[model samples]
Target chain A: MDFAPLLGKANFWAYFFIMLTGLYGMAVKRNLVKKIIGLGIFQTAIMLFYVSIGSKEGATIPILTAADAAGRGGIDAAAYINPLPHVLMLTAIVVSVATLGVALALTLRLWRRYGTLEEDEILARLRGDPGGEACTPRS
Target chain B: MIQEINAAILLLLMVCAVAALQVRDLMGAAILFGAYSFLMCLQWVSLGAVDVGFTEATIGAGVSSALFFAAIFRTTRRTKD
Candidate 1:
């Protein structure tokens, strides 16, 4: 019924869609590398949302120039955008990169040992299905 | 903050995310992901987050893409099914 409010927040919804796309890729894709790509997308969609909320219209970044500091009695806090979200997102980005690197390394190791990056094939070989070599199921 | 640029970047981001997932070549998808990250940094700068823009540019676009390329080169390139 009320489309105005919905349209006003188009940016948030767009990011939500991106997150959904990432989730779909992670959940449905059989390839380990593809899943890592999805994870990267998912992390960024959220970080983008955080950075946006910290910004303010008609306000500058949190840093203050010397001229503004020298001329004013103190300064209006409202003139600068919020810095907390940006700081938090910075930590988030670093952690996500570390996570991605470790994940890819694990994927590399999996590829080396199993000889395939596809999840199902890897599992099948682990279960000793093809060529009857690795696991040797005994029950 | 530039509202128009943010909107355009958001649209491009969504497209890139989907395309990166759908592409058959993992290396090509990694480059698309780099483009997505760079566009995201632009959005952050236009939103007045300069520090964030720089961080994303270096880490997301540069470092993460390099990681992906390394992973892809070490593993298979084409996907089946």
Candidate 2:
């Protein structure tokens, strides 16, 4: 099999690395805030991959520079990159922002009640560890 | 070439991600995350997704960073691990 083509697929490799890095941060990090950052990174990597896939090697931006819709002539759609991914990604970006905001708010509440942002400490407190026996789960 | 540019940006992005993950300071990690978003936005624009890139610039780099800093303000900046 010819493996040379894979070297040219920089976008694919970049996205793969970013996704794995994010996954590592989420799965291995002990801090709650770091996990949120990882989640954002993971989401951004997916969006980047989708956008890259929608691009064509010889295409221009999706917008038509001239008024071809004015009926003087028809616009050649092939000249422009596909617009569907861009539109879908707009909605995705908004959703990510909303989710980030909510997650941060929850993090704030957790910090306020527990006085720490470390996942292990929170779990310890929840389990009524000896040193954290004074801590009780808040309803 | 387009591939070279993408490779450079991707390298920088990975560096930022690693730094953000390893930093002991939460605020520093948030700032690095913002830089990561900007690099990703540039990659999107270079790949011909201007609309998606613009959205990422505003939401990922701008609003998200602001929210992270605000959240950091409410908590201690130092991480235990």
Worst 10 residues of 1 chain B by lDDT: B1-10
Writing each residue's lDDT as its tens digit, candidate 1 over A1-139 gives: 9765654465688779988988998988778888998999999989878876777778887885565645773456889889899999999999989999999999999988998887777877878788634532422
Off by over 4 Å in 1: A1-8, A68-74, A131-139
For candidate 2 chain B, the 10 contiguous residues with the lowest summed lDDT are B1-10
CAPRI class assigned to model 1: medium
TM-scores for every predicted model: 0.88, 0.89
lDDT of each: 0.85, 0.86
Clashing pairs in 2: none
The DockQ leader among the candidates is 2
Compose the digit string of candidate 1's lDDT tens values, residues B1-81: 356566778889899999999998888889999999999898788778899889999999999999999888888897742
Error of 1 at A137 (Å): 23
Chain A TM-score by candidate, in order: 0.81, 0.83
